[model samples]
Structures are given as C-alpha cells and as structure tokens.
Target: MSNYIVEMLNIRKEFPGIVANNNVNLQLKKGEIHALLGENGAGKSTLMNVLFGLYQPEKGEIRVKGEVVKISDPNIANRLGIGMVHQHFMLVDTFTVAQNIILGSEPKKKGVFVDLKQAEKEIVELSERYGLRVDPKAKIRDISVGMQQRAEILKTLYRGAEVIILDEPTAVLTPQEIKELIGIMKSLINEGISIILITHKLKEIMEVCDRCTVIRKGEGIGTVNVSETNVDELASLMVGRDIVFTTEKTPAKPKDTILSIKNLEVKDSRQAVMVKGLNLNIQAGEIVGVAGIDGNGQSELIEAITGLRKVESGEILLHNKSITHLSTRKVTEAGVAHIPQDRHKFGLVLEYPIGENMVLQTYYQKPFSNFKVLSFKNIYQYASRLIEDYDVRTPSTRTKARALSGGNQQKAIIAREVDRSPDLLIAAQPTRGLDVGAIENIHKRLIKERDKGRAILLVSFELDEIINVSDRIAVMFDGQIVAEVKPEETNEQELGLLMAGSSKEKAGEL
Candidate 1:
C-alpha cells in the first residue's frame, strides 16, 4: 500500500498563449498539511485547479490511495472526496450561513422539502468539532470576512470532503483569525483529513506545514521538509533570488500638510456609521500608515477620502483647498491617486485588456487621447513601459486583466496610480497577496514616491508593514483615531494591543 493519500505526477496544463503548469509533480502524505509555495505567477493556482477538476491537464496521472482516478469535473472531484475553497470565496451574499453551507449537498426530509433544521444542526456540530466558530443563523453579507471563510470551509466539510485544498486562505484574515485557522487545520488533520495549502507566505508554511513543494515559472523546483529548511532557502527557491526582509529608507523631512481631514464621519452601504469624528493629516514627503484590525473604519475612511463613499459630515482639504463632497473624477483631477483595497471591485475592469486598464486614470488627457479619440499606439506604449518598469508579468499588454494573477493585477494598479505622480496617494492593502520580493519592490517604489515630495496615506492589517513602511502610524479603534505614534518607537505587539482597543498606557504595561 502507498503511504501517499494523493499523487499528481508530471502535470501539464496550458492556456492560449501561456503554459501554466509544466511537468509539475505533487505528492500528499496521509493526514499531513502540504504547502504549495511559489511566486505570484508561478502556477500555484493552476496546479490546484487541475487537482480540483476545474481544469483538464494535458498530461498527468493522479492516484488516490494507490488507485488511478480521472477527475473530470467538480462533482467528480467531490465524489472522490476532494473539495476546494477558492481564494475569492464563492458564497451567496443573500443566503444565510446554514443555507450557504448546505447549498448543493443539502439534507432532505421524507424525500420532499429541504431539511434546514437538520442541516443547521449538522453544521453546528461540524463547526464545533473543527473549532470553527461560525453563527449558523447569520446572513453571509452581515458576517465578517473571517466568518465567511469559515462558512466556506464548512461547505466543504458538509459535502464529506476528506481532502481539502485552501488557496491563499489567510490573505484576507486578521492575525487572530489566522491563528484560529491554523488551529482548525490542525484539528482537521487530527481527524485524518489531509490538506493542501496554496500560499506565498513563508512564515505560514514554516509554522503549520509539514513539507513544502516549490514551483517557479510553471515548473517544479523541488520539495523540502519544513523541519529541515528555513525561510531564506525557501524564498530563494521560489523567487530565484535572495530576498530582503527589511526596506531601505532615510528619515522623512516632512513638509507642510498636503491632505487634512477633520471631524470626518462616513457610513457603510447599510447606513451604519463606520467612521466617526476622525481627524488626521498627511504631510508632504511622509507616509502616514493607518493600522487597525479589519473593518475598523479603515475601508470607510479610504472610500471617503477618495470620493467613493460620501462623507456624512466633515471637511477634507487638499493643499489647504477644501475637496469635500467632490466626485471621483474631480478628486482624481485635483491630484489624488488611489490604490483601492478591493482590486476587482474598484481598481480594474476585469473584461478590459491590461493596456487599457493602465490608462484608466489619465486616458482622457494628453498623448492617450485627442478630441476624445483614443490613441492605441500611445496607450500601448505607456502600458508596455509601466509593465516592464513595475515587473508586471503578463503574456502581453493585450491580455485581459482577469487572466493575470492577483499580484500582477495589483502591480498594474500600483503602476497606474503611482505613475500619475499625484499630490496624495492612498494605498489600501497594497501588498495583500504578494510575495516577499514583490512586497520589497513595492515598498521601494512607495519610498521613492515619498522622496519625490508626494504624501501617502497607507492602510494595512499587517502590523509589520505599517511599522516598516510608514514614518508615522495611526491606530484606529471603534471608528476613531485613538492614538498616533512613530513606528520606530513601537513594536507589533504594542500595535496589536492598541488595535484591539488597548490604551497606550495599557499597551506599555503589557
């Protein structure tokens, strides 16, 4: 009998112009958490999709428990005890948690109507068994992102999945939630369920995974035992270079305030007050990073500043000129650039080509257009320059934005927003799903922009990023700016406590 629970040998998958996976091999031992580590476009998701039966591999042999099997579709994969939780969740916002969990594989009553109460009971039992605390009665739209992810996992378990694949699972979770997820994964393994984790976070792999398989540029680099390997070696194998953990920068010479907000109040789509009575300022040649747990008014504040969300009552001044209640276009014209938190929702048009998305901000002016007629020649030329300058790995500028990897999409947005050289740049979760190398490059670029006298407002859940990239850090708690501190003087533990509503004095005491 084979010790491996699953084996994919010499997998090859291809798109129209790109060979996504080439001779990639993966072997999963029974009940072990195997990590798939790679760069942004290094074909991690493509390989997982093949395993989940979302894509057909041109050449490969998959063996489950020493017997070869052909998984032609998701239903087949599920029947064969496989399930996948995608990076972007596939849950219905209008459905309740129990309804979403038992969506497809629902329980029946007397061979008639759907038995929702039984489903809820089973879901509650499963959640408790796996240490996943999710409310079955809550609506999907009302719950937090972490809770939504738990529902996704419960969906898999509800279908009797013995093998689970999680793609970038912690990319949107907070630190505490990530720790909880690790515990859940451990509990699942204890129950004899094997897991395949697809992520770019080396630290996560080191902490939870038993072994790792590294892929670079669509080919398998090698596999190593996590117990014997370190982060440096794994990073070098994935990125083909020695990655730098810290950013190089000089002390900021902050000039006059370029953007100021006073008594800002904003509401969410549900008309609930999210940002209340907030005050802050970003000076020229400085990066003011807002550090907070997710949903603590960070999203609303960014939306209010960039004109995406209406401010209920407050004043926003750019260059000492009031810009309150301005339209998005007016905000852009008034020298404000934004790298939005949700890239697909606000940053890029998925159906458009990468070249066109590059010129989204300035296409109406200058070389890109004349007399309201677009110049494809200048537009593509500009796109090509930024693509090369920012290391956006794409088959061509004509590729659809949806075809590119998440990190590349983010890079394209950063290139577009940063190239405008606006007076104030708002970067929200800029490096959410990126590798260490890409994060380093973006950090360097942001610093370069700061050096060029552009003020930046950064908001991130990664406490290390707030400390490493920002000159000044603001902690938000309960829709208000609770405290402002220099990054050099505080540590992540203190920041974490403050973000959780601990007073500065209490943080110091801890």
Candidate 2:
C-alpha cells in the first residue's frame, strides 16, 4: 500500500583505500522514472551496484514496499523483481538474441529441451508490447548497439522485473534511437514499472526523468522534481559550483588549410573499409566538427590522420607537408597532437602514475630528462602543475591513473596532449563522459587553441557539442563525408537528414 517502491537509506560501500559510497540515500516511487546525476566517478554506479546486489554495503538498509529485505546476490535481486542494465553490456557475442535472453529461464517443452517456438512467440509479444523491438533470431555480434541494448532490456523484462535500472542508456545510441528508448521508457511506466536512469547528460535527464537525485563525492546532495530545476541548477547541485554550460567564442577567421585529407580510405581491424574517400580539411584558426552516428568511419578517419591506420589510397598533409604512412610518433613530431577516441588504449597507461602519464609523449626528451634516466622531481613538478591548472581533482602525482574517474582521466590526457603546442589538435569525443563543468572548460581550451592559429578537428556524436563547438560541420554516412555546412546556417533537422544519407539535391533544397 506504500507509494514508494524501493529505498536505499544511508548506504556505505568501500574498496581498498577508497570509500566509494558515503552515506548515499535513494528512494524510488512506484511507476515513476528517477535519475541519478553525478560526475563519472562521483559514485553513481557504486550506489546502483549496491541495489543490484553486486556489492554488499558496509552500512545501511534496503527496503522494498516499506519492508526491509536482504538481497545477498544478483540472483536474489532478480527473484525480487529487480533488474539492472549495465553501461558496458554483458552479452555473449556468439549467441543469438533469443538464446541470450532465455539462457537461464528458457521455456521447456520436452523436459530438457528449450521450446524455441514458444520462446520466440513470447519474446515477440513482449517486445511489441513494450516498444523494445529486437531481432530475436539475429546473432548478438551482428546486431547494432541500439539493438543489443533493447535485447538486454527484453532479457530483464522477460524475467518479470517490475523495477528496472538503466545505466547511461543513451551513451551509444543515435538521435532517432534515443527517441525510441524514451518511448519505451514511457510504455514501461504506463505498465506500472518503476525505472531508474543513471546518466551524465543533463539534457536527457531533463527530457525523460520525473525527478533527479544529485550526488557528489559519494554523498547525496538532494533530489528535485525535474520540472522545477534546469540544467544550470542541476549541474551546480551535482558539482557544487555555479558553472557555465556554453563556450564563449567569437566567429572563426578563415585562413589557408592547415590539415588536409584528400580521398582518404582506411581499413579497420576487421579488414573493412571504415573510411571511404573521407575528404576533409581543417583550416588555421577554425574548428571543423565531424558529426555522425557511431561506426560510420569517424574512428578510422582520426586513426588514419594520426598515422595509426594505413591509408590505402589518399593523402594526409600537415601544413602542406605530406604525412601519410608516417608512424604515430613521427606524426606527433610533425606538429600534430591527437587525443585519440579510445583514451584507455592510446591516451594513458592505467598502471602508470599521473607523473608518468603527463610525460607519455615527450618524457624521453625535454626539461624532464636529458637522455636516459627520468628525473622523478621534474616529472612530479610537471604533472602537479598540469593537475592544478586543469582542475583534475587528484590528490597527488603519485596516484595511479586507474584510480581517477573517467572525467579526470580525460582531463589529464588533454593536459598532456593540448599543452604540447601542436599546430593541429585532433580531439575525438573529447568530452564524451565529462560532466558539465569539465565540458565547459574543455570547450574554452579548444577555442583558445583555435584562436591561437591552431587547427582543430573535432569528432563527436553529441549533436549539442558538435553544433556549439564547431564552426563548420561535416556529416558522415556509410564511411564517407556526405555534406558540409556552416553551423550557424544549419539546423539539426538538415544535419539529421544528411546523417541518414539523403541525396545532395534533397538535403540542399529541403
């Protein structure tokens, strides 16, 4: 008879030397969507892990329907009608959608054999009822990320879960797919299902959630009705600071091309032509943003430009100097600072301390060292200065990179790469996982670099970021640059059409 469906009161969780959650409290009203807002490492995921029975809280109690309950494991939580969809998917790549969904709870017909027909029929009905359409027969590896996410959702729903938790649900979805996800959430709400949305995107929180709980540094700040608070207010509550959201920059002054790509083609690890005839250029003192859905050759384009991928038939010129077929280090030496898309692989060494990560590019040379042995003092000083200037929020330079949050890690990488003073600064999804304040700072820094005669090539999936930070926008579709437009002259609709691979005649006139 209670209005509240579930509540976690004064939760405390710890690991090694860190207290992940410090007295965090959360309450969920039945059939209402609630959002958990925080920075990357502010313990949003840690708190949710407690609810899903992934971690046992050192203190505090979990109550369901006003009755205290002990959830010892995920199996127990599942049996209690609680389900969680993790940000990083947990699906078997080799299995079909139906197999993955009905792995443990498969319908039986011949005692030991799974009833494929019955399972497919029920799955199709469930997907249609909830607006989570999925190709149940398709292999998990062959389906799109959006489809995989829907499949995961179906798996939870199939288990008769009345309470669902979605972590960064729209992180990898396209604009259209995001719309579909919102629709599905609405359907679930109508069906008397309670939902929890965990995300960093304030806009998505504003659009979908009923109420939001702000958390910072493992403590619950407060919860507010979504209608009563704006992004500025929500951001300040989460970060404990009055932060600006937009980048303040004058119009770009056009100049000669600084970085040029001519008919470039790049093959990915799977031997696919990821970038097909990707022709683009970044001019001095201007920012050119590549906007597209994921897996449409943005990664390959950046890799080819930064000398990570082999160019099959094209040219990459840095200030009129051909740099195609060059090594990554050689490309860096040729006046290019590339912040790779995958920060973990190409940005920083997780095992290395902050001091060592700061000098990843130029540690062997420069003021830090003479030739062989690294001067620990110089390294520490350099790293400390960057951490202070960038507001990286690290206690010491001796802290391992892995210990830092995703946003802090990104900031450290940017501090090292952007500070090197390269003529061409290639930033790919630079603020993908950063909070609002960090995003504002990055935008300002990138604009400063552009104004100082450096060319910036930004690739991002977030439309707001692409529009706000870019002077010129290029739309990629099916491994090619389809259309280019001035940001001020374009709207999201036109760009959306171009992203869907509309014809030049249709897009130009429409």
Candidate 3:
C-alpha cells in the first residue's frame, strides 16, 4: 500500500495560447501540511483545479489511497473526500453563514425543506471543534473578509474533507488574522487532517508546512523537507534565480511637499466614517509608507486621495494646489498616478484588451486618441513597449485583461501607472500577490521613480515592504496617523506596537 493519500501523475492541462500545466506531478503524504510553492502563473492553481474537478487534464492519472479514480466534477471530488478553498471565495452574499455552509449538504427535516435549526447547531459545533469562530446567523455580506474565509474552510470540512486544498488563504488577511489561521491549520493537522497550501509566501511555508513542492513555469521543479530547507533556497527553486530579499537603493533626497492631506475626513460608500481628521505629507524624491493593520483607514485614505471616495471635510492638496473633491480625471490631469489596491475593482477593465487597458488613464490625451477617436496602432505600440519593459507575460497585447494571471495583471497596472511619470504616485499594495522576482522588479521601479524626484505614498500591510522601501513610515491606528518614524529608527516589533496604538515609549518598555 502507498503511504501517499493523493497522487496526481504527469498532469497536463492546456488552454488556448497557453499550456498551464505540463507534466506536473504532485504527491501528498498522509497527515502532512504540504505547500505548493510557485509564481503566480506557474500552474499551481491549475494543478489544484484539476484535482478539485474544476478542469479536466488532457493527460494525468489520479490515485486516492492507492486506488485509481476518475473525478469529472466537483460532486465527484466531494464524494472522494477532496475539498478546495479558492483564493476568491464562492459564497452567496444573500445567504446566512449556515445557509452558505449547508447549501448542498443540508440536513432535511421532513424530506421537503432544510432543517435550519439542526444545521445551525451543527455549524456551531463544527466551528468550535475547528476553532473557526463565525456567527451562524450572520449574513455573508455583513461579515468581515476573514469571517468569510473561515466560512469557506467550514464549507470544505463540513463535507468530510480528509485532504484539503487552501489557495492563498492569507493573501487578504491582516497580521492578526494570519496568526489565527496558522493556529487553525496546526490544530487541523494535529487532528490528522492533511492540507495542501498553495502560496508563495516563504515565511508561512517555512513556519507551517511539513514539506514543499516547487513549480516554475508549469513544470514541477522539486520537493524538499521544510525543516531542512531555508527561505533563500526555496525562493531560488521557485523563481530559478538568486532572490534579493531586500531592495538596494540610496537614501531619499526629499525637498518640497508634493502632496499634503490636512485634516482630511472621508467616508465609505456606506457613509461610514473611515478616514477621520487625517494629516499626511509626502515630499518630492521620497517614499512615505503608511503601515497599519488592514481596515485602519488605509483604503479610504487612498480613495480620498485618488478622488474615488467623497471627502466629508478637510482638504487634499497636490503641489500646494487643492485637489479635494476633484473629479478622477481632473486629479489624474494634475499629475497624480494611482495603482489602486483592488486591481480588478479600480485598476483595469476586464473586458477590454490589454493594450486598451494600458492607456486607460492617458487614452484621451495626445498620441493615444484625438477628437475622441482612439488610435489602436499607437495603443498597441505603447502596450508592447510596456509589456517588454515590465516583463508582463501575456500571449499578446490583444488578449483580454481578464485572461492574464494576477501577477501579470498587477505588472500591467504598474507599467501603466509608472510610465506616466507623475509628480505624486500612490502605490497601494503594489506587490500584493506577486512572486519574489516580480516583487523585486516592482520594488526597483518604485525606488527608481522616487530617485527621479517623484513623491510616492506607499500603503502596504507587509511590514518588510514598509520598512525596506519607505524612507519615512507613518503608523495609522483607528483612522488616524498615530506616529511618524524613520525606517532606521524602528523595527517591525516597534512598528507593530505603534500600529496597534501603543506609544513609542510604551512599545520600548514592552
């Protein structure tokens, strides 16, 4: 009998113009937390989708507990005790937690309707058992992102998932939530459940995974024991290069203030106060990083600056000129560039071609368009230049923006925003879901922009990025700028404390 619980041999999946997975093999041992490590488009998700029955592989053999099986759909995979939690959740917003969790596998009371009471009771028990606390009666739309993720995990476990697949589970979570998730994974593994975590975060893999299988450009590179390998080795295996974790750049030469937010008050779409009396200043030739836990007014502050959200009061100035309540186009015209936090939401048009998306902000200007008539020739030429320069891997500039991988999409946004050479650049979560190579490239571009006298406001939850990329760091807590400190004067520990509302002297004492 084989010790492996699940085995996918020589899997081959192809899409139009791209071979997603080519002869990729994955073996999962019983009762082990394994990591599927790779770049964004390196076929990690494709291989998992093949296993979860979302896509059929043209060539592969799947074995479950030493028995060969054919899985053609999600129902079949569920019957075979395989469950997957995708990066983007699949939940009905109108449904309650219990409703979403027990949708297909609901307990019938009278063989006619769902047993709501029984389902809620069972959900409570299951959540307690797994330490995934979620209100059973809470609506999905009203709950936080972390709670929704927990509900996703519960959906899999409720269906008897002996072998679970988690795809980038910690990407959107706060640092606190990530620690809780790590604890939950440990508890699940202790209870004899196996997990295959699909991620590129070397820190999480090293801390949680028992072993790791690396894939690069649709082919399996190798697998190594987590305890025996280091982060640098894992990074090299994943990206096929010696990864420089820290970006090298000269000190900032800050001059006049490029952007100033004085007593800014902003509200969300729901009319809730998010950014309250916030004051921030960014000078030319410097990067000012806003470091905070997620939901601490970062999104609202960025939106307020970019003219996406309404300012309830106060002012935003670009180059000493008031830009508060200006139209987005007006703000863009005033030499402001924004790489929004949610790429799909505000950055790109999914239905448009990659070339058209490249000139979204500047298309109405010269060269791209004249008298409201777009010039496809110039658009494609410009996109081609950016694609080559920024290393945006795509079939062609004619490809739809939706067809590109997350990292590639992010790269395209960076190319479009950075090429404009604006005076003040707002980069929000610039390297959110990219691999080491792509991250290094993006970081270099940001620093280069700063060196060229562009004032940059970087908002990121990644502490390392905030520390390494920014010359000055502002710690935000509860919709306010709590403290300002230089990178050289603080560590992650001190910054974390300040972000949580602890003063410098208190943090030092702690």
Candidate 4:
C-alpha cells in the first residue's frame, strides 16, 4: 500500500488554444502541509481543479490510499473526503454562516426539513475543534473576510473532509489574520488532516509548509523539503531566474501640487461615515503611499477621490480645480486614473473580451471609434501591445477576461491604467495577488511614472511595499492622516505600531 494519502500522476488538462496542465504530478502525505508554488498562469490552480473534480484530466491517474478511482464531479470528490476552497470565496452574502456551511448536505428533522439548529451545534463544535473561532449565526455579509474564510473551512469540515485544498488562502488576509490562519493549519494537521496550499508568497511557504512542489509553465519542476531550501532558490525555480525583491530608484524631486483634498468626509454603503475630515496633498514627481490596517477608511477615501462615492463635505482639487461632485467620467477626463482595489467590480468587465476591456476607457475616442463606429482592428492591435508589454499570459486578445487567471487579470488592469499617462494615478492594492517578478515590474513602472512628473497615490496593506516604493509614507487611522514619515526613516515595526493607533512618540520610543 502507498504511504501517500493522495497522488496525481502525469495529469494533463487543456482548454481551447492552451495547455493549462501537462504531465503534472503531486503527492500529499497525511498530517502534512504541502505547498504548491508557481508563477501566475503556471497551471497550479488547473491541476488542483482536476483533483477537486471541477475539471477532468485528459490523461493521468489519481490514487487515494493506493486505490485508483475516477472522480466525475465535485460531489464524487466530496464523497472521497476531498474539499476545495477556491481563491474567490463561494459564499452567498444573504446566507448565515451555519446555513452556508451545511448547504448541500444538511442535517434533517425526521428526514424531511433541514435541522438548522443541529447544524449550527455541529458547526460550533467543528470550529472549536480546529480553533477556527467562527460565529455560526453571523451573516456572511456582516463578517470580516477572515471570518468568512473560517466559514468556508467549517463547510468543508462539515462535509467530513480529510484533505483540504486552500487556494491563495493568505492573499486577502491581514497580517494578524494570516498568523491566526497559520495556527489553524497547524491544528488541522495535528488531527491528521492533509493540506495542499496553493500560493506564490515565498515567505509564507518557508514559514508554514513542510515541503514544496514547483511548477513552471504547466510542467512540474521538482519538489523539495522546506528545511533544505532558501527563498532565493525557490524563487529562481519558480520564475526560471533569480528574482530581485527590492525596486531601485533615485530620489524624488517634488514639484507643484497635483491633487489636494481638504476636510474630506465620506460614507459607506451602510450610511456610516468612514472618511472623517481627512486632508492630504500630492505633488508631481512624488509617490505618496498610504499605509493602514484594513477598514481604516482606505476604500472610502479612494472612492471619493475617484468620484465613485459621494463626498458629503470636502473639496477635491485636481490641478487647482475643484472636482468634488464630478461624475466618474468627468473625473477620468480631468487626467485622473484609478486602479481599483476590487478588480472584478471596478477594473474590468468580466463578460467582455480582453481587447474590449483594454479599451473600455478610450473606446469612444478616435483611432478606436469614428462617429460612433467601432474599430476592432485598432482596439485589438492596442491590446496586443499592452499584453506583450505587461506579460499577460492569455491565448489571445479575444479571450474573455474571466478566462484568464486572477493575476493575469490584474496585470491587464495595470497595463490599461498606467498606459494612460494621467496627471494623478491612484493605485489601490495594485500588487495584491501578484508574484515577486510581477511586483518588481509594477514597482519599476510606478517609479517611472513618478520620474515623468506624475503624482501617484498608492494605497496598500503591505508595509514592505510602502516602505520600498514610496518616497513619503502617510499613516492613516480612523479616516484621517495621523502621521507622515519618509520611507527610509521608518520600519515595519514602527509602522505596525502607528497603524494600530499608537502615538508617534510611543512608536519611536519602542
């Protein structure tokens, strides 16, 4: 009998005009956390999809406990104790945590109606056992993203999953939440539950995983124990080259102010004020990064500046002209470009072709359109250039935006926004799910724009990015700019203290 709990050997999967996975192999042992590392669009997710029965391999065999079996659907995979948590969560906003957990396979009352009370009791027990700390009665929409992720795990546990697949689990979590999740993974493994963690974050793999398997462009490179390898070796193996972690740039020469926000106040969808009397200024040829914990009114402030939300009381000036109440189109016309935090919601139209999405902002203008007549040739030609320049891996420009991987979709959005040469470019979580190589490229581009005398406002949750890329760091707390410091003078520890509302003197003293 094989010692492995799950094994996928020589798997091959293909889509139209692309080979997503070819001859990929993976083996997971019981009571271990195995990491699958790869670059964006490198077929890591495709291989896992095959294992979860979301897609069948054209050629390969799967073995569970040395028994060969064919998994025809997700239900069949679930029956075999396999459960997958996707990158984008699949929970309904209106459903409660307990309801979502026991959705398909629910406890019944007299074998008829759902026994939701019993389901909640079982879910509570399961969450406690794994140290997940989830509230079963909370609505999905009302909980934090970390809590929602815990609900997803509870759902898998409710289905009796012995093997869990976590796809980009830490991509959307905060630093504190990430630490908590690592603890939960350790506890799960202690109970003999195997895990396959798919991620590109090298630091996370080094910290949490026992072993790692590398894949490049749809082929398995090799697998190595975590203790035997360093981050440099793993990065080189994943991208076929040595990766540079820091971006190099010269000192900034600040010029006149390009954007000025005075006494800004904004509210969220729930009619609660998020941005409270905030004030900021950005000068040309300078990159000012906003560093804060999540839910510190970063999203609301960005929306107000980009004209996606109403500014209840404040003034937003671009080039010394007021634009507080202007429409989003007018704001864009006034030389302001935005790379939104939620790419799917604001950056791209998923149903459109990549070529069309590329020209969404400029399609009505000349070269792309003439007298309301569309020009497909020019649009596609433009998209092809950006695709090549940004290294977006797609079969063709005509491919649907949804067909591309999450990182590719993000690259497409960045390409469009940066190519515009706007006076003020606002980038929110620009490198959220990108690999190290892609991050290096983006940081270089931002610096290039700053050197070109453009004012850039960068909002990110990553303290490393803020310190490395920004000339000036603005620490936000409770919807206001509490402190400003030069990047070279500050470190992550001090920033973390300030982000948690610590006084500047206290931060410096500590």
Count of steric clashes across candidates, in order: 0, 0, 0, 0
lDDT of each: 0.94, 0.88, 0.92, 0.94
How does model 1 fare in lDDT? 0.94
Q: Residue 283 deviation, candidate 3, in Å?
A: 0.7
Q: Residue-wise lDDT of candidate 1 within 1-510, one digit each (tens)?
A: 888989999999998888999999999998999999999899999998998899999998998888899988998888888899999999999999999998888889998889999999999999999988899989999998889999999899989899999999998888888998999999999999999999988999999999999999999998999999999999999999998878999999899999999999999999999999999999999999999988799999998988899999999999999888999999999999999989999999999999999999889998999999999999999999999999998999999999898888999999999999999999999998998889989999999999999999999988889999999999999899999999999999999899999999999888
lDDT of 4 by residue, 219-238 (tens): 99989999999999999999
lDDT, residue 56, candidate 2: 96
User: Which stretches in model 2 have alpha-carbon errors above 4 Å?
Assistant: 15-19, 102-122, 254-256, 268-274, 344-359, 363-381, 393-404, 502-510
lDDT of 4 at 355: 83
In model 1, the runs with Cα more than 4 Å from the true position are: none
- TM-scores, all candidates, are 0.97, 0.89, 0.97, 0.99
Better of 1 and 4 by TM-score: 4
| Candidate 4 accuracy as lDDT | 0.94
Higher TM-score: candidate 3 or 4? Answer: 4
For candidate 3, lDDT tens digit of each residue in 1-510? 999999999999998888899988889998899999998789898899999999999998999999998899989999998999998789999999999999999999889888999999999999999899999999999998889999999999899999899998987788898899999999888878889999879999999999999999999888899999999999999999899999999999999999999999888878888888999999999999999988889999998888888889999999999999899999999999999988988999999999899999989888998899988899999999999999888888999998887778989999999999999999999998788889988999999999999999999999999999999999999999999999988899999999989997897776
Model 2 scores a TM of 0.89
Where does candidate 4 have its weakest 10-residue lDDT segment? Answer: 432-441
Error of 3 at 401 (Å): 2.3
